[model samples]
Target: MTGDLVTGLRSALSIRFVNTGTGPCTDMVFTVGLPPGIVLLGGTDRVVLPVLAAGRTHVHELTLQARTPGPFDLVCTNFSYRDENHEPVRVTGWRAGLSVRAAPVVAPVPQPTGRLGVICETPNLVLGAWDELRILVINDAGIPLEDVMMAVTGPFSGAVPRSRISVLGPGMMARFTFQVNVAEAGRHVPLTARTTYTSGGAVTRTQVDHLTVAAQPPVPPSPPPSSVPQSILYLAANPRDLPPLRSDEEMRRVKERLQLARNRDRYRIEPALAVRFDDISQSLVDHQPAVVHFSGHGDRDGNLGIEDNDGRCTKVTPEGLAALFSLHSRTLRCVILNACYSERLAWQLAPHVGHVVGMRSAIGDPAAIEFSVGFYLGLFDGHPVPDAFARGRAHLLSRPGLAPEHQTPVLFPPGPSW
Candidate 1:
């Protein structure tokens, strides 16, 4: 089940966030109007809110649990208090999941019945690498699927590999995958499985299984070093469990919710996108990646906030970062900062990275993540930076808390060297 709600509303919700004690504020709001019919209107009625703010962000976490499905029109705006000189001050906002359809519990997938055998297209008996394998899932049941989920578990305490699968249908299979690589190699290994399926937006059904992870062949030696060039490597790092500032006893309840609410196998939309934030320079260093993405909290000065293995945050200094990549032989094609106040980062990194792209003003977490995601996906679909930016803007502006005319992702073109 997806955990984010995104919509579009550029004409309303103009409430300025008054953080009487901060440097600047990033207050964004929006509204969404439903279409002809198809609205999320059923089952366990409850409202899910996605708001983004800094130290004072949680001020608006008031719960409105009664949710009714319908065509909802959302309005969002940024309210900034004018200075004594009437100067416009700035603050960063973290509006993530606003674009997500708040209540994902509604039956989006078709339903299924009887001994439904979900064929996984994922490879069998592959090499045991650090990364998990991708599996292609096809729903072979005759019925339309709805709210379908699955897991890969084992008997022992260590062999529990549980995860949820997204929308699947008759002849409308999804390429779902999961990895539970056994640290100790063996034969006929069992991967216990359990599934929960909502009957055509009504009832919930389940399934279970015991699978295997065949051993791998001997490690292959390095290939011959030809005169050819090196291929690019894309790395998405997730720092899910931010080392708790408090002890486990104090966070036992909070921690359990964290674990339950997560579909670890899938990319998540959280306070920040840990996937991109955890590994910033590694993007430029290891992969010599043609493109780099930094998604997290930031300030107007290009200062990025990142948590290390210990969950201790450190803002990367601009000049120091520029020099870090300078030692690398792999020249970059471009660098994207999908964090708040990333525009300032783009300007600072322009000279270091070959092509730079960032937002001129601060952006919400969800919008920033969506914007960057759309950009990369568009690239694979063959759109250039400027064109991709337009596509990104179209998607970002459509989210619930963003203004249709919001100035997002300020870009810096490729250098003369390109």
Candidate 2:
């Protein structure tokens, strides 16, 4: 039975009883035990079936009324009747239990007089780790707010809290929380949040908050190197209908490039969630990678393409990308985005990560591959992120017959190296 039971309402339950005897039976009696909060309203627990023949069945229904919200049970404690030979027989039937919840409380939307207010309660500054950003949006205008969308840009990565809300009643408020991760330790990293919504058949957008990032105490020194090889996570997605990217060749080249680094004792590369977008976080948590690399297509508007369940291209917004990276900000030292127009993502990720590299504009396939190959090669050679990025660019520049369009990859916020 449906368990959303409201007080003072009647609920009905039906039970089936069957007899498999050689002849008809008589004096049928069935007793039910009901738990507290449920009372029999119209049906009796004991029922008389004057005659129940062989291979026959009977259905018994009970009507009950709930007194309050709680769990209730209907147990058949005893079933006694006479068999074909006039012998006494008894059987115990199954019990059914259900929980009831209080009716939901809904508040009406108030009318506003033209004031819309927003407040953000976030840490004054964050360093070298992830934190939460809580914001409250109030519908102070006289009209109701609909289709609200929020965007946050800062040194963080992941989904923005309450990115899209269906409605906000006038004078009512809604609270949203976002995860903020800081990759690099610094002072005064600027953050901006904005909200756009439809009100009274018109669209309006406003900047919600201006925040800052601060440096935290440096992380403790690493323990003596262990025998385990350092893992590098490489995530790639190329959905259907888009120009085919050479991801397979790219992975092969990545292994080849890392091998050339010849530091097998220290680093081992691993491919994660080849084309699955939902498994990205699970892969990160399972691997705890030191470096994270994403190879996919990116749009100028800050949406990165990842495959949906149907293998179709699905765009993940900049805020979502940033929020995802924040989860691994502690272990992730560097990130590489080998996709076209990923600079926006890089900036959003730079604060919570040690280093981030993204493309300034569209980059050709050949150039993108070379850049990734060179970057990993430099890393294996003990070069820092800046040096690795430079090496990648240099390798692209040196490629034979390299096109002029290949030099779009750029590193973000080039000062105070991590």
Candidate 3:
């Protein structure tokens, strides 16, 4: 006997009767005894065969439904038949256990209401950045919708979160955000968002959107020989709305540390103060610097604070920064986000830049300056990016009252020998 006896729902059990005698058998009867909590759905408890030919087999199947979750045994209580010699024979000893698991709770399907709508919102999609994809589910009917499900399918890098709404009232809508990362860049990347709900009956709505990925910025001509000595572009921003940062002091200390290095002639620092949002891209193009450093304010969400047109604080997201830096990957070797809560930004920039340094948590001005000095000192001594990051942390620990922030600085991609 064989069956899918171990299940949470309905199952099937089959019994096989084989005649191994040289001649045919007659008057064969078989009975199955079922344990408690198991019900025979549509089959009888016993089966009888009028005649069984020699070396032939017959199968009887029983449909069973488990009423409770437990282990139960199905046994064959009786098996009697007349052998070819007109002799009666009885056999017993057929038992099988069924382990029934508890059935999962399923929500009831909602009744159809009126109409359902799906809307997809896609901002500027950039290659190799975690971009946001927003989906809105709207109930246009006059009734409520229960168990609304939203799913998205696209050429994304990782898993996309599934959105669910238990109830959506009439004229109500729910918005969901999906962090999508795509590797390929093209003029049009197709994205589809599907939403299922009851609108009168089961209704499904699909919204398709084409996303255009921006290409990398073009590289500008090389700077003249006079600017060849300047390889590091230091950008500092202090907007009026946000708390003022000691970026000037940080820049000054960095210049002094680099000047004192044994190979000072091989490197030079170019400072851009009160950096505006637009100036970031222009500076990279004009200087074509090997190293780009930003000292400013960063929010917990990893948005860097930069100057707007009116000299007010403006925010730049990590995704935007990653896309912008990708354009300079040909010439840029490393990036240092010397601001608080920049660890996430560092990770985003790692794919494009060879090395990146960021702060794991909020850092005070003194620690930031000390780290910048130590990091530059290491670089001047021909230490690689990771080693220089360690040097920065060591400097922070050695400073008076700054030891607590020693682990604030973090390096991405641990090893970048260059």
Clashes of each: 45, 11, 4
Per-residue lDDT over 1-418 for candidate 3, one digit per residue giving the tens place of the 0 to 100 score? 7775544467887788888989999999888898988888868999999999999999898888887887778888988989999799898797777677777786765554555655443424567777766665667766777677776777778885568777888877677667777766664566666666554345654433333333222336777655346489999999998888898888888888877888787777888888886899899888899899999999898999999888898899998998898888777888999999998788778757778999889999999999999999999878887888888888888877999998888776654321
Residue 244, model 1: Cα distance from true site in angstroms: 12
1-418: candidate 2 lDDT, tens digit per residue: 3334566777776767677878989988878788877787877878788789889988887787778887777676877889999999887775777776666675554434565565543423456557766556777676788887777776565554447788988767666667767565665666676877776556465546675656565557899988898788889888886888887788899898777766756888778644666778788888899988888888997788988888888888888878888778778888888898897787777766878888878887888888888878888888888888888877877877664644677675452222
Q: Would you give me the overall lDDT of model 3?
A: 0.79
lDDT of 2: 0.75
Clash count (model 1, backbone only): 45
TM-score of 3: 0.51
Judge candidate 2 at residue 264 and give its lDDT: 54
Candidate 1 deviation (Cα RMSD) = 33.5
Higher-TM-score candidate among 1 and 2?
2
Look at candidate 3 and tell me the lDDT of residue 57: 95
Candidate 3 to native Cα RMSD, angstroms: 12.7
**Model 3 clashing residue pairs (backbone):** 112-199, 112-200, 113-199, 113-200
Full candidate order by lDDT, most accurate first: 3, 2, 1
lDDT string, candidate 1, 377-412, tens digits: 455444566766666676676776755424667666
Which model, 1 or 2, shows the larger lDDT?
2
CA RMSD per model (angstroms) = 33.5, 23.5, 12.7
